[model samples]
Target: MRLIEKVWFNSHPAKYLLVPLLLPLSGLFWLLSTLRRLSFKVGLARSVKLTKPVIVVGNIGVGGNGKTPVVIYLVELSRSLGLTPGVISRGYGGQAPHYPYLVTAESTAVEAGDEPVLIQQRCQVAVAVGSDRIASAELLIAQGCDIIISDDGLQHYRLERDLELIVVDGQRLFGNGLLLPAGPLREGQWRLSTSDLVIYNGKKAKKNANQPLTMTLAATEVANVQSGQCIKLLDFIKLNPSVNAIAGIGAPQRFFDTLKTNKFNVKKQQSFVDHHSFTLADFSDFDDTIALIMTEKDAVKCQGFCQSHWWYLPVDATFSDVDRALLTDKIKALL
Candidate 1:
């Protein structure tokens, strides 16, 4: 974890000094965010409502709280319901040639953001990437999509949404419970009350009306990053008991933990900043004989220069039967 992240999520002694120093900036962030949201709410700023309903799957905090997996799950659910769903992303860490670029099979993580490309590849759904989400949504709509899914735009009040789903990291639920700079949240915890649903990405706490849903990421297989050959996770683990693992996601530890849970003897686990652009040199030190494993999100970015021994674990979001029915019913209502 980075120093600031340690200060935010871990019990670092720096928190005693850093929190006080960053509290003023957090207050400023709260003020600006509150004003921006209120402007849309009070009609001071215009919020464009699209022809189709938009389901925003996002989180209040900044780090990876498993929002992308939830978005992917929703896309699959929409397909199961026979509704055409498209995804729109801000394309962070990407420099596209044009505005509202439509993701194609040839799309690279450099052209479109990693998450959008991952979604497009895994779900085979229309994905639009750009800073102007409204424009991106319009592009998706033009492609005959019946519904839209915003990847991580909880604070982008410019585009009006029909439903808001806030994902929370059940393990580190709102570290310090303070706003950005001082902590990890973009908005306060109270924002959860106003959201349509609160989905926990890990072992959920005592269930109540406020947090009725939980999601688990289930990993079943590992695929060769270069050849696209698939193998059962256990089969691969049995052959290679000790391996190297790396993750470039919002919460790298979560990916590491998942590997550990699956009984992979992780010899060397490395964590990189989220959406890190990987180069061939990044893995120069890793032993080639031992398999190198990574999260699918990081795998998407490494495919261009990946080695034969490199593999990626793909995880799917799973819910209990009751929660699945509840979610299905809620989505059906949207139709």
Candidate 2:
């Protein structure tokens, strides 16, 4: 059933008879979403207040929109400013959402989920997962955390938030432009107008979408998981001009494209579903392959069994000057 949601949401084509049924059904879903939003807006459903500020980074579209990297960027920037930040996630594919569980160095990708493990590796901050996002936020607060950065809770109204940053996949803005069962939007497109900030992390922004935040891929380097060997983009290109790559992300092609821009000739690019929890069996047949490289998000789930040949590429998000100032200012206000 859960698997069906992923497929159905991604490719819900419209038909005439389905229109009558879907129109009303989408209307109902919209109404419920609207009522839920109104409830929070009007205080019918009170939002939780914490000693620290909660900054939520998420997308309106169902699938990923650079959520993890945005969260990582937030954490990194906050830490440089001397704030002790804690992270919270729904743990989309983990085993412990039934209870509030901490993400630690010892936590496996299976237990803590792939994204959380990646966050733990990148941020080294306190992390936890639970269905009750508010509870997960509170747990982080209890750990002496003063600032909370939620990975993806744009629609989780129950959790409450101080700052709302909507991450948009510029390439696929509001696909089909209809609500669920009709299109990709979880709510109406107008939802973006209300967000405190809109981040366009892709190649371009939507028409007339101003004050837009843009990003360019920074340097790319490969790090050997087992031996801790770090190689520059040039070195990897020099060593092996061509290699096989795998990416289980919202946009696998981005990584592949980045590799190509760096002058490497990639032969095969295997893309899996986002937040993919990799299993050893997935790579069983690809044994002795030294040139397999993937993003850090995918690498976390594949770390323990990562062979000397397997490497992870690290890249950073580069924002424009105006956008960077706006982002930093909004986040700083949380204090």
Candidate 3:
């Protein structure tokens, strides 16, 4: 992680002292964001147009609004629309691809990032990861991609987008309703107002929204790692009624809640900062035999050092036809 990101989340009171600096930092961010938006407004930095259209699946929350499944849905939706789509991601925890580079199934999570690799495996779409998202889009285009679908980038002003979809956790909505160091918002609420459309997986969209989409994942899916195969969700419940659950996501409880909904016998839960690089010590204090279920994002980092009885339940989201029509119409209006 970058030094800045590391310090931004430190909960020490001394870090709170840095909030004053956040005033200038936030102002500068807003200024840069404003100037970039103006450039698009006046057509200074031209947005590269795709032959088909571009759809971005993202949210303002720092993490975990079920963005991955949404991206997968876009891949399938594009195919259904008879468009060949390519996916772009910033590769937050993966190797830093200085510019856009194509991802492959053999790509390691450490090299290409887990989410992008998972997307590649699930949708069989061209996947690229880099900081310069616009350049990545061009790379995908050069390879004959008809449309571009960016994962987790609504505020990436560099990438000009045709359609925008925001996924908000029904529970968090907006954490503390503050921006940046003060809270979890990457951009303000008004950004949603200006977006082409909004989708609330667990949250409701504004009443004035021209269109809205809602999606939910299946109760469970198979977890594949190591040589271990086909562990039933019920198996965990029957064996450990007072087991501990650990998660490192924007909302760890969300994962825990899903497990409970599936009738897991969880008796305690541990929440880690999102993208936490787990250490051996993290598991030392836990009951050695208790099952450890984690999100796929976290599983990327955990796979190598995982202890006993570890598994990650993969999730897939489903959207209704009505919501699909609304989303398609919004993209059509922009295209």
The global C-alpha lDDT for each of the candidates, from Candidate 1 onward, is 0.91, 0.78, 0.73
RMSD values, in order shown: 1.1, 3.3, 4.0
The model with the greater TM-score, 2 or 3, is 2
Best by TM-score: 1
Candidate 2 has an lDDT of 0.78
Best by lDDT: 1
How far residue 272's Cα lies from its native spot in candidate 1, in Å, is: 0.4
Error of 3 at 235 (Å): 5.4
Model 1: which ten-residue window has the lowest total lDDT? Answer: 203-212
lDDT: worst 10-residue window of model 3: 1-10
TM-scores of the models, in the order given: 0.98, 0.88, 0.83
Off by over 4 Å in 3: 1-25, 96-98, 239-242, 328-335
Residue 140's lDDT within candidate 2 is 87
Q: Is candidate 1 or candidate 3 better by lDDT?
A: 1
Candidate order by lDDT, highest to lowest? Answer: 1, 2, 3
User: Model 3, range 154-248, lDDT digits (tens) per residue?
Assistant: 87766667888888776667654556765567787777777766777755555755366677776555364443465566664566565667788
Per-residue lDDT of 253 in model 1:
94
Clashing pairs in 1: none
TM-score of 1: 0.98
Q: Give the better candidate number (1 or 3) by TM-score.
A: 1
Tens digits of per-residue lDDT, candidate 2, 145-231, equal 999999988999877689988888766567667787655678766777777877887666655453457766576678876676888
